[model samples]
Target: MRIALIYPPPWKIAAREETVSYGHDGPPPGHRPQDLDADFYQTPYGLFTLGAEALRAGHRVKVLNLSAYAWSRVEEVIAGLDADVFGMSCWTANRRGVALTARCIREHHPKAHIVVGGPHATPLATEMLEHHPEIDTVSLGESDATFLELLGRLELGKPTSGIAGTVYREGDAIRKGPERRAIHDLDTLASPHTYFDTHIVMTSRGCPWACTFCGAETTWGRGFRGHSVRYVLDALERVLARLPVKMLQIKDDTFTTNKKRVLELCHGIRERGLQFFWSCDTRVDLLTEPLLREMRLAGCQRLSLGVESGSQAILDAIDKKITPDEILESTEMAKRVGIKVRYYMMLGNRGETRHTFQETLDFLDRARPHEYIFSCLSIYPGTRDFHDAEAAGFVDREVFFTETFQELKTPFDASEEDTHRMNEWFFANSGLRIVHRDGVADYRAILERLGDYHAAHMDLGAALYHAGDLEGAEHHVRRALELGYPLPGLVHNHLACIAHARGDLDGMMNHFSHAAKVDPQHFVLIQNVNAARAWFKQGGPGRKLPLQLTVRHDFQLLERTVQPTLPGPLPEDWKAWNAIALPAEPSATYLRTPDVEGSQHVLKTRTRLKVVV
Candidate 1:
């Protein structure tokens, strides 16, 4: 049996513009935004675990990272793979891209069996099947065992009705199986690192906290499930055998959830002399000097603390369960222990306002985590915040996910204009200078003074581009470039957009090429370069010239040399693509048509494939 795991690309905004500052004040003097590459090393734990399971079952397994690869090249990569089954993992942000990828695979290989899993699928199983006919099954909940079982049944040419937690198509109807049991014994599961040859490991499953905006509780439940200390150390040993294992990214929602267990694990790592650096996520309140010192001694290089809000009101509203004092103390303690700390802040929570937003700024100034991540909250289905928003009259019940504006879905009950203003203020104030006055009401004045010159011009250029005023956009962009602004990557990207709009194919290519050159390691710029190349090769009407920007020596080599590889088997024709196996027992009603408009346009077509057995 052959299995292919596909991780779709992230949203353009998140992948390109969202930098993983971890807690840095801002991008270096002249910082540029770039695309986030989906390295095999960075592949999600679930996908790697499932891949390892498939391999353990004697199936040929491959990982197709379409996220790291440009969208245009997806078909080429799919055409190059050789596999029997295709599996895809997607989050809410990248659902559209996943759907598009599934459709493309079905169009190219109609006989290949397709499956969709991950956080997105768990809550939207019915919607996924109804919306995308090309997907043969949606593996709801934990899929490591269920997926392997489904593969076994398929290989034997047997009916898959016995396999629980799967939704598949049968004739004109879709059939869903009974809910599968979750993995209780963590030791039985193989290390995901075995499949990827990477150092990433999951020490625990499930989050202890119920953050209002998070969907983790709904997907994995609130109770924390962890592997034994022995199991974790064994996994680490296995990983160190294969790779240099510089950084062990513990993909636990809260590594410090079980204080005793974490301490035990830390002690084990120290005793074993693992001599490897690691990072983990934890709550601000969980940090203690003892734990921090023990972790640092055991090579815990970094910690990501979710200081979701600085305002006590917002924190309580979201059940963040930490106070400002706790946040400050935790930061100071981590810094004292010589441990790098990254603060993950949520900007748009319930009860967010100009005042509360300012409180966050003041908190950052006080706490001073190594990096600050300010993100607008998203109202995902199944979260308490989502229901609360509807209950509080923020979101209309009639509005579907697609119809809801991205900014409006935030837990923060504020106008879009206000949100934008706060976003601008957060970025501007996160720099070296204190550009904002504590009691000043002059928003525009503060923006003009504290904001990066190039960043402001870039914003204006972006507005013009969105307004379809390409020429005006180009003029502002050129001004940004000529100002000798430090953010060359952003400047180059805007120039690319201008070139794209003005029918300057060479100029578009040159700008993207320049952006990529300036920040060769930046995934966003790399993606832009790939997109530009693909568009140009397709004879599109845009700039097609290469960039002339300079970059760091190693980064330049990485850009020129690194190429993403395909994950699964390729099919010759579209007719052999596999359809999702519908459930034998109907538990819910299936709508003939999806609730949203244009959904049918995006729906995937199904094809029949012959079983290998």
Candidate 2:
């Protein structure tokens, strides 16, 4: 059987003047805020899982990420592709794209089986089928097993209507199958990491907590389930080897739900000599000093906590059973072990008010985490917030289909005045915030807890250099290399800075040259190297200029030169599809989507850097 999986764009996008070529060597240039505000570019991880399953069953699978492609290009690609089963991963932001792509596929391949499954499609399966005649089936919830079964039945020319965990059209009426039980033994499923090269990895499914703003429970059922420690370790080993950068985001709903499992996994990482910096998201209440210490030793770089709001009343209203104190204590603990603490703050929840809004800002000041990001409450289809809104007549199921917003980013039950104030604040104060930086003492404490760790040595060295202890900094930086720090370019970059401080012009350039050759892909390293090149181009040390250096263990890598590729047949019109030229200028309705309100920010970004497709 021939299977095609697609990740659609958020909306119909007109091509821009400048061309941004996709490459397989690395991701396109880092996302500029205005051009790529939402995370729509990332191909949904589920598609890889489904593709892996199909491949194991001896079926050919082709996966394409058309998330940022222009509408014309998308149409061209869709028209060129032929498959028996066409699967798409839908989300609230990309619902419009899913429909558009489905229609394209239906027109191109009249007999192809179009299946849509995702958070958005799962909750509104019946509506999706009723409104969009192009989609043949909607797989609800965790769909690995459901998808494979559907494929088998389709291959044998059997009816797909009776498959569990699916809703399909039958004689002009939509019929839903029986509820599918969640997979108890996750190890039974093939690991997507074995076949795909993606920085995103989810070792667990479902969050035990029923936060009203979250739709996780709806997506993965009520309780939490995780792959066994060994399974996760094996997956990690495989994924890390394939990734260009050893940094990964373990995008679980609640990564540390089972503290014991995480601890054992952390220990296994060190024992197996798996050296990589990684980040995970979890609740504050789930973290502990010991677990954090072990995690840092095993190369845990950052811990992101979902601290939605600071007001206890607001927290209770949203059913977030955690206190502000817990958030603070967890921040301190993670910071103590040299793990960067990032808080995911939210605005305009159930009981949000001007006072409560101020409380959140005050709490941020008090907590002083390493980083924080704020987002407005978006009422999705399967969340309690959505149900409550529907009941109160604030919104209906049709809004998701009709409205053009990337997400319904609005205040839940807040006064018009309060909503106005919150919107004003949010517009001014959105995006990531680096609130704090670890000092020498902080990194020293980390070294104490995690003895002889390469990352710790490098971190301490950077801190020392920043604190103007050049000699002490040099020693630790050299020790990091001796301990086999994975990113030696960072080490040499630091050495270059130290050389500059000591008036060794030749040594500084030598070190800089080495950093550029070895680690030219990292964004920070690229910036610094460019600065050095410009400096030398202008004049030598005789110019008497103070060279500014970016001295930090920024764990970010360069974006992929191209999108992820799978082992499958190329599109029939691959050459023509790649040759399609973008319009020199956008049309009047280019930014018609509500998510993209204005073109000013986008224009600003475009003039500065090439937009990554």
For lDDT, the strongest prediction is 2
Model 1 per-residue lDDT at 297: 63
Query: Residue-wise lDDT of candidate 2 within 107-181, one digit each (tens)?
Result: 999999999999999999999999899999999999999999999999999989888999999988999999999
CA-lDDT, candidates in order:
0.62, 0.79
TM-score quality measure for candidate 2: 0.89
Candidate No. with top TM-score: 2
Give the runs in model 2 whose Cα sits over 4 Å from its true position: 18-38, 516-519, 540-542, 565-613
Clashes of each: 44, 8
